[model samples]
Target: MIKHLRGVWISCLLILGVGPSAGWAGVDSDISSSRYPSIQAALDANPGKVVEVAPGIHEIHDTIRIVTAGGGLVGSGRIIQMDPARPIVRIDHASGATLRGLTLTRPEGRRETESEAVIATDTHDLALVDLRVIDNQTRGAAIELRNCVDGQIRNCLVQNYQRVAVDDRTATPDQGFAFRCIIGTGILIRECQGTLIQGNRVREDRLVATPEVKRQHGLGQIIKKNAVRGRIASQRDWDRGETDNWMQGTAIHVGSPETTDNTQVIGNLVERAGQGFDIHADHVILSQNIVNDALVGMKAMHGSKHVIVTGNQFIKNTLWSIGMMPGASSLPSRAAQGGQPARAANVDGGSIIANNIITDFGLGQTRWIWGEENVGCPIRFDHGQVPENPPLVDVIIQGNLVYDTGRDTLIKEGKPEVVPPRYRYAVLVESGPSAPVGLHFSNNLFHPGVRGISNIELKP
Candidate 1:
């Protein structure tokens, strides 16, 4: 029966003018610089075809685009972006476009830019498999998918993605948060639905935010003099030139609260990031991920809802291992007493955080920034930006484990000390008008740091 179906599919492809041999024409055909004048020429010659690149470094001066439906590029080749302003590859409005087993990077001078290594926008069934995006420092993401549905970014590697970037949010003065510099991101899924981000590794190669490194890079001088400043986001750190380090990049981020939905982030590894996973969407399943040596292990906020976080391991995180809060877009103006809508209508809650493990809290790369001052927590439920925003509700925190190794950990390069667990509480629930509500905690095993399990008693 399977053979019959395969024959039928082959017949259908033949009827559609796609010969079976044509599909495999470029596979291992040595489409190198000698055969093809440029990679774009090879792609333009073969529309709707899968062109396999040979095993060598290929320089791309212009943006390589895959716009035709069912068109793609694959094979074991390294593409270095010589163009600083453009993405290495852009898949615009393409369906079933696949970029597999390719290494995308940029030269050192071209690294600091807003362009992503591979960006797929308005695509469907886009598969980015076994791709390596390395040493491409940008304020934006290394791999970005926007308005793409049913896409998969699997078995990919994003390394050293964080560059010191300006976090300019000065336009929205109503929020009272303004400009500061920050790091970049690894993989960003914006307004994407039913996306599967599995078996990927996002990591930093070097410590970019250290005092010496920051001085050498002139990290503090990157902020422009005319940049609007209402109130700095991290005021204390901003004064100390430490805001950029603390606000480093997320390894994986799912944003676009009103549009993004039903994302599965499974079995990924994140190391040495600002936030391991910054989730700002709804209906997300974050499972079996390992986040090591990050500022925050994971945070679901910015109007996120119905998120299920389970079976993840967070290790050596300086900030909260797990955090959920309402954001600026949490409530519509009509839903609140005196709320003014900012971007879109959304809310926070209906989330489940269960069976997760957190070890070596307050021992990440940002430990020097935060210090051992009881600054971190295993779990936290916090408030929104404004009092008028609706509170987070209906969250279940169950079966989690917070264990401390009680050993000497690395503070920084050549600084290893037995720093005690710098946690305020195992679980912290903030108290305010917009504090999280309807939170249920049960069967969580924890080792207390400064305070016990929680500041407020939770009902099991």
Candidate 2:
């Protein structure tokens, strides 16, 4: 294994640009340190060649912009961001650009930023492959793609990408609750069509929400100013608390402005996350993923439609395993600017949640942080944020399984102790004016929780 890994490292080094050693003596590169003083200088001189970064630590204070067509970067090198205000790399309108085999990170104090380590905007056929994004902590996403078409992020590892962020919802009257500090995301995709996120692993190593860690970071504090001035929305039953651990952040967050479509999130693993997959797009296919030790397994909401969630596993989740709901963006006003079809209509449902498995319910790392009244349901469907929006409609939940092993395997360094699963029901569906219409459940296998199976009928 060590030999194989060493060989891989060497191969990646060669791909990125190795030194003029005996083994790499005859290889020719488009641009290298021997040929150019710096990467920017090489790109400035040759705007269309791939900047071959040498296999070592390269620190930069300003963003490396890639704007020309066919301009790209490749190397198994480490690029450290020295300035907190600037991104490590930014690709704008660089069609057919490629960034691969790179390690992007920031130094100790330089980890915090509002910008991403890598941001791609208005790019088509952009490929980010075999990349390692580590410890680039931020209130924003570690890797963000905006308005890009036909992009793919594959075989990437994003570790410790979250920083504490203040989520202020004071401006919205419907979302009166706010968090003083919340975690940030790993990968964020917005308005990107035909994007494929595959074979990636997103995890948290250090910013765990242990009791002491929460106090040390001043997290989970109540925003009294926002709470007092604005009335908390009636649907926000989960926000009733003095202080939570601020376990809020998605491992992969896709879409929000209600323009992104045709996304596929497949074959990914998200461990120790606040939320595994937060989907807010249209025509999404979420399949063959594993979410372990998270607060939530996944959720599809906010005008999302035709989402197919299948063949996934959710383990050791403290909160609900799967959630589907509507948001403020799902209002009918989103379908039109002045009573005409302007963009894709804002609507929810016509989605299928099937063939998923949920195990070890309420056994997450932060399981102790939540109370029985609020957390732990294997499947949940909720209502819209505003009354004017259409209710979640025409959904099918089938062939899913939820089983409790009555033990917590997440507790390391000890014998697995027998603990009853902490959950209300196998499935929880809200009922009201905003209740989902034409809901169907069939062929599901579930172990009864505190409240047995579900509250609503499941026939047809």
Candidate 3:
């Protein structure tokens, strides 16, 4: 099946005239760069043809929607400026649509809400490869792939995003200077099967810019006089200069149990995202990814089954490294709200968490996260949230190194919050009257020390 899919992908690329790229002749005829002024014009003139963009900035006013089989809109050294109202590239119900080597960006503007940079819904054999999405300001996710089949987003770089912070700890608009903090996911794969998201990197903490980035979309303004709180604030000082606190979105968000059943997220680097990978899918394999600096490392909600989280280095996350809870559509804030309910009632089948190194949790965070009903905990098995069903049938937590900084374990002792409900624990199981079934906690190394004292047993 894998070989057949690869063969299909290669045949689609060849049919789109991707290979023999220099000479540029495929099954379909090629269009010259000068034939159409804008990228959309080229795509419109030749459907199912390979449209190559020149090495310059393409200011897109509207969404360039495409429906073509065995065709692509390719770019190299191309910076496509996105209109906030619309996605720069929209492929709808098309098969074999490829978008590669394009940089899509939307600078901070007067408009508060922005849509996705690229949206492909109901597409098959779609590949978004080696694309760099920089500094998008979106109310929605950056990349929205819905009901897509046999598609993959590989070797892509989605970085340096700071939208208007929804829940800023400090430096509000009333504070004189506006703050644009990091939010939103890199890609939202909703009900998409045969999808592989691999070798992608998503980050938000970027202050310095390369010459190429500055020349592309004026990213230099973020570090200068117009620097938002996220741009100028020090690592420890979230509100020092002009800080905004937003921890709501994920780097990669996978949704649905029926459509997202066979998806695999492998070898990705997710940092400083809202949630590294907010997963609600089943038969999902999340492996070999470095997940760090997020509110939560990886969240497996109520509906997820046959999920495997292994070989991942989860570091510096604030609340919980890996949280297994009932379905809430979104993360909670201090004001008392919860995510939407999960589609599936219970978490059945075998879920594996093995060989992961989770350390330095709740360190370098902007604010104290009220975890597991306002207590500081590293790993959460939340049975209290979803009272309707028995939470887990088989949960294997083995061969992992879990560590906690002093404050994360003992929140009341180490830097207690100004607010109420100060509590602490490292491993938390919120079952209330009903304890969890099929729980396994063994062969794990716990390190909690001040310098000489081994507080491993002391660690909760």
Shift of residue 351 alpha carbon in model 1, Å: 0.8
Per-residue lDDT over 1-460 for candidate 2, one digit per residue giving the tens place of the 0 to 100 score: 9999999999888776674442223322457633677777777787866777788998888998899887777777798989999989999999888888789999997788888989999999988887999988888899999999999999999999888877766677765565656578899999899999999999998887687877776776656434443433443333554456478878999976378989999999999999999999889999999999998899888889999999999998887989998877786644455766655468889999999999888867878776563367889898876677689889999999998767434344576666655788888888878988878999999887777788876776
- Scored by TM-score, the top model is 2
Model 3 lDDT-worst window of ten: 451-460
Q: Across residues 313-394, which tens digit of lDDT does each residue of candidate 3 receive?
A: 8887766777775543322223323774444333543788888888766563522433233234556676524334445547
Off by over 4 Å in 1: 1-34, 174-180, 218-245, 333-345, 407-419
Q: Which residue runs of candidate 2 sit more than 4 Å off their true CA positions?
A: 1-29, 224-245, 333-344, 407-418
Candidate 3 off by > 4 Å: 1-30, 77-79, 108-112, 165-183, 206-246, 328-349, 367-375, 404-424, 433-435, 448-460
Using alpha carbons, what is the TM-score of model 1? 0.85
User: What is candidate 1's lDDT per residue for 1-460, written digit by digit as tens?
Assistant: 9999999999998776687444432233334333678878887887777777877999989999999988888877899999888999999988988888889999877787788999999999999988999988888999999999999999999998887656654466532233344578999999899999999999997654466765655554424322433332455644443344436588999999889999999999998888999999999999999999887899998789899999999998876889998877677535434564444558899999999999888766677765455787888899877766789999998999988666545455688766556787888999987888899888989777777777998886
Which of 1 and 3 is ahead in TM-score? 1
TM-score of each: 0.85, 0.88, 0.71
The per-prediction CA RMSD against the true structure, in angstroms, equals 6.2, 5.3, 11.4
Indicate the residue-level lDDT of 328 in model 1.
70
